[model samples]
Target: MENQNLNKILSGEKLSIDEEMVPGTIHLVDLEGTLNVKKESGSQSNIILQPQPSSNPNDPLRWPKRKKLAQFSLLWFWAFMQAVAVNWSGPIWTLWTETFDCTYMQLNISSAICFIFLGIGCVFLQPTAMKMGRRFVYLGCTIIAIVSNIIGSQGNSVQVLYVVNLLSGFAAAPVDSLVEISTTDVFYQHERASYLAWFILALYAGSDLGPVACGYIVETLSWRWCYYIQIIIFGVLLIVQLFYMEDTTFERIDRDDLEDKIIQQMKSRETILSAVQSGQLSQERVNSDEKLNAIVSVNNSINTDDDDESVDSSIPMRTYWQKMRLVETEYNDSRSWLTIFYRPFFLISFPAVIWGGVVYGSQMMWLSLLATTQSEIYSLPPYNFTTPQVGLTNFGALIGSLFGMAYGGPFVDWITIKLSKRNNGILEPEFRLWTMIVPTIFNAAGLLAYGLGAAYEAHWFVSAGIGQWLLGFAMSSSGAICLTYSVDSYPKLASEGLVLMLFIRNCIGCGFTFAIQPWLTRNGLKVTTWLMFMLSIIINGSFVVLIKWGKDFRRATKNNYYKYSDPMFGELFKK
Candidate 1:
């Protein structure tokens, strides 16, 4: 009987089950009036009554809070290590130029090559993660990074260094996108900004810390020791990850239970038919049974429908593979890769990204330039500071980063959640931008101070302190606002948006770092600082326009922005 019912359900026939059947038992019987026998069970019918599909307790989000923290920590640590490795090459750029007898342009090309590969890595790593899973991809990339660092350290030729730099950038690509994605996967929306902020803090902190640590090493030991430091950190991170980070893959829900329920209903109908053929029961009895069975079957169907709905709603519509191939026709037909890449350019084209590019890129440029230039400017007569002392200038940026991390992450998150609640569970990605106001003012002030301080050759400490606070605040707020807004505005295309931002930001940073030195030497720091200040004013001032009219903008270009399609978009825009 069970076999017949199972087969019937598998074949797409609906079955009705009794409400009083024994638990875990499949009952096959005829409905009181029906001419066919079908499977009916009270307990099996109840399976559909549950509201949600059971989540695996082993899932990363279900892991203990302490475990989640540990995972987050490990991610931050690896990010920091990668950041350090990137800038470690900065302090040693002069050394490489002198040793290899390469021109400044060639030396800059080495760093630029690393950054270019970083962007290329971003494009491929996300796709790789979808196939092999995030854990495997992260581990593989870190290991490759470790090996590249060691090889680069041992290389004696400029060509070898360039090749190693490119490879290292490729290997470290996962650290950028994967970490951000993983953080979002494991944490709730409210907690994401804070966690992301922490991640960025570690990233910038490494930039500051890397040069200082490597400068001392390069001065006392060989430039090769700088790469050695990265290898050691990578080794430590690799072990930490193996034990702590678990795969956060979304589970596939099974439909076998639904199939089985359908089978049981079929068997009940078959039983009724057989009884009629055998004349074991009168027509009256069969009719009564049929009515009872119909009621039970309807109830069972409802339960099954409920279960299916719950399961469907809990899982996101797009899976990892679908997201991986969003641009490819093999995955979706709505749009092409070229379309996806160019869409944002046409949509928001707000000077926000351009300004963000300037803010972030210029900071990196100035930091690198200042590190090398300080020695020539201040080390000779009055200060006579060594390479390590010059590296200490990074202390301001470091201090500012710490302060930004503490304030930006939790504060932005709290404000977003509070604003979301007042708005009735609807979140406008614009709420995240509110916190940027202060950071903008600070950033503008910092640029003005750093540029003027350098121009006047004022107290070194004054310039460092101003630069630190400004860049620090700007990094924290601008980064937080840009990411949050991108995610909220284009949740479906969040990854693509991130890729665009990353590419623009890195390219700008690389450009400025290469050009700032020459520009400052030719134009003077005062002139350059004013240029940055004016840029910030224009960029920061746009926020007023956006905050006041952003919703109108979103509504005007409904096709361009996904936030418009969201049910909450209309209501939220009213506020």
Candidate 2:
């Protein structure tokens, strides 16, 4: 009976059964055929078929609007918690120094390790997610992070702290990459910049909010509570995810089975037609068979054609694992990860990434320096606050992040959309870039104010306000533009491009934090910050060059970019 049903289905005979009963099975049948089958109980079922391989409305893209938004929100919250966990320890650096018997530099090393491992983990986790699928990778990484947090909280040694920080960073990598991919998966191309802007805003908000929350906690309770707090948060997020997050990977509809069914149906139709013409088949039988065959053939053709058209019309799909294989091949031939590392180097080596890096790095460096400098410079007897209070200077960054999130992100997207429409539906990635001009000018002015304020011992609020407003807007605009531009310009290699930007940006930030303090102390805040302000003007000003010549740059580098695409961008660029 099973064999007969299979033969009939293959021959494009329509079978009557609940469609849900054949879940995960691919049926290929002619669009114009009648399917008849007898059950074990001698019950006959007949289906007047249309075609095989019909479009299933069960795809993630076809999900209900509310359900889709809920998915995005859940992923956003997941990313936020991961960001908070990594940076929560940042504000409590002083406590760690005292408890672990380490210097400020040593504590910085631990924080740096978290970021460094984040980059390193992306190399592995991204490919793993591509291979194993998003849901599994995300769930697995969250579990690893939970365990890492538990182990980190119980650690007594500095060595253990460093190891756990690195492990936790490794575990956290999937959250960012997966969330970005998932957001891209659900949103349309036109809507991506805004969605991504929000995602980044959430990310920065978590980073900024972490210190304030952790500062209050460490001040009143033990430093261990910071980790404990994250553990609880992670637990709650994990539970929410288990109940809410749906799998979003693209499931390919099988074409081979459908093709075979169509072939069989065509043969069955010819047999029935010949029998009818020769008068071996009755008119009733002939009519029924002809009607069924027509229905099945049309159905099969439409299904097959739809599947073929979809594959032809859209970008080729390759899992990250498959791209990694190509990368490995290239690596074996070239004996280098140059293809991976050099992707962002072109952009990084560009004056824009560097200048952006300097302005951004300087902000971070000066903020750290000013925080610590407060106690020494002020010298108020009672208000001689400890390192944590100095760390409270991070609140400036928090304030800036909020301003950026609230104003900068949406402004960039709105302006870009308007400009894109003005260009007759052509959206240059550079459209989103023009919004950076005001922020750039403001950032330089902010630095200048911070410098004068700090050097002359002006009101603390003066330095904080200038720094916060400038840094907030600068971080918001630069981060939004750089990321959006890279994704738009190199949508295929967006992940790699971002990784490159992150590498150079953070390297500058970390390097300058060490150098900026000593340099400012020796040269005076006025000279140091003025120099930084001048440098920012130089760096931020280069956006004009990028906005004008970016397409030219892309054209010049197209060959290399195309070669890199095979390994870096996967099948997306093949379009």
Residue 444 of candidate 1: its Cα lDDT? Answer: 81
* CA displacement after TM-score superposition, residue 132 of candidate 2 (Å): 1.8
Clashes of each: 35, 31
How far out, in Å, is residue 89 in model 1?
3.6
TM-score of 2: 0.66
Q: Cα RMSD (Å) between model 2 and the true structure?
A: 14.4
The list of candidate 2 runs beyond 4 A from truth reads 1-59, 174-178, 251-383, 386-396, 450-452, 513-527, 562-575
Write candidate 2's Cα lDDT for 283-360 as tens digits: 575446655445334223221112333333344343444432312221121212344444445555333334444444
Q: Candidate 1's residue-wise lDDT over 1-575, tens digit each?
A: 64554345335555555543211112112223221222211334122211122333333444455767977887788888887777665556656667887765666666667777777777666655544567767778789889889888888777877788788778767655667777765664556678888888877788788878877987899888888878888888888666655655433233244224544545565665565576754556645764534623333343222133323345454444543431223212123234333443442353333444444544455455554454455445555566677667777888888888776788887786666656643456667778878877887887777767766877777677776667766766566666656555544444555656666666766676567667767887688779878877776556666577655554454454434223223232232
Number of the top lDDT candidate = 1
Residue 381 displacement in candidate 1 (angstroms): 5.1
